[model samples]
Target: MTTTFYEEIGGSDTIRTIVDRFYEGVATDELLRPRDPEEDLGPAADRFALFLIQYWGGPTTYSDNRGHPRLRMRHAPFAVTPAAKERWLVHFRAGLDAADLTPEQDAQFWDYVTHAAQFMVNSLE
Candidate 1:
């Protein structure tokens, strides 16, 4: 049987690491920081970690707690413009890099993230 991406990438621990790193970048990012009004990013990081775990074929904790992702609806209030997407990608890419995924794994993951980022763009700017 083929190993799931979650397993191949080292499961929850690695996902947590990625989320932590990603939020580290987000905390200081001007474009992305304001989108999260929380003074502490811990909640956001936890939610994202769960979401990635479910997305990559791991446990279903995210949906178990939050129901369907409704990603667009959740992000609708934010001005997700092209520039914002790029800024988000920049930090996410850093998180991806910190994962040290294999070349093939990185490509696959990058493809998904880039596509998702573009899809999240609700504005032309």
Candidate 2:
């Protein structure tokens, strides 16, 4: 059987660690914290963990629960400015670093997030 990027990177546990660490950063971020209206970040973290897991090729549970990701559309409610994107990447970089994947795996994962962050920018401000 062919292994997936999810499996290659150590599956759900790694993804959860990455998401948890990312949220740890987000919890204290002024800009990012305002973006999440919820006082408790757990649900948001859970959603993100599921999304990353599915996107990286694990179970389809994210879609199963949330339907199509419609990423840009879903993110439309937020300003998503370039600065916000940069800040988002900074926290995400911490998450990636915590995962400690192989260099190639790290590069691949980073490449996707960099582009995704840029794509998420909905405002020039």
* Maximum-TM-score candidate: 2
The residue-by-residue lDDT of candidate 2 on 26-49, one tens digit each, is 999998899999999999999999
| Candidate 1 segments exceeding 4 Å error | none
- Clash totals, every prediction: 0, 0
In terms of lDDT, the best-performing candidate is 2
Question: What tens digits encode model 1's per-residue C-alpha lDDT throughout 41-106?
Answer: 999999999999999999999999999999999999988999999988998889989996899988
Clashing residue pairs found in predicted model 1 = none
- Sliding window of 10 residues with minimal summed lDDT for model 2: 91-100
lDDT of 1: 0.93
Model 1, position 23, has a per-residue lDDT of 95
lDDT for each candidate structure? 0.93, 0.95
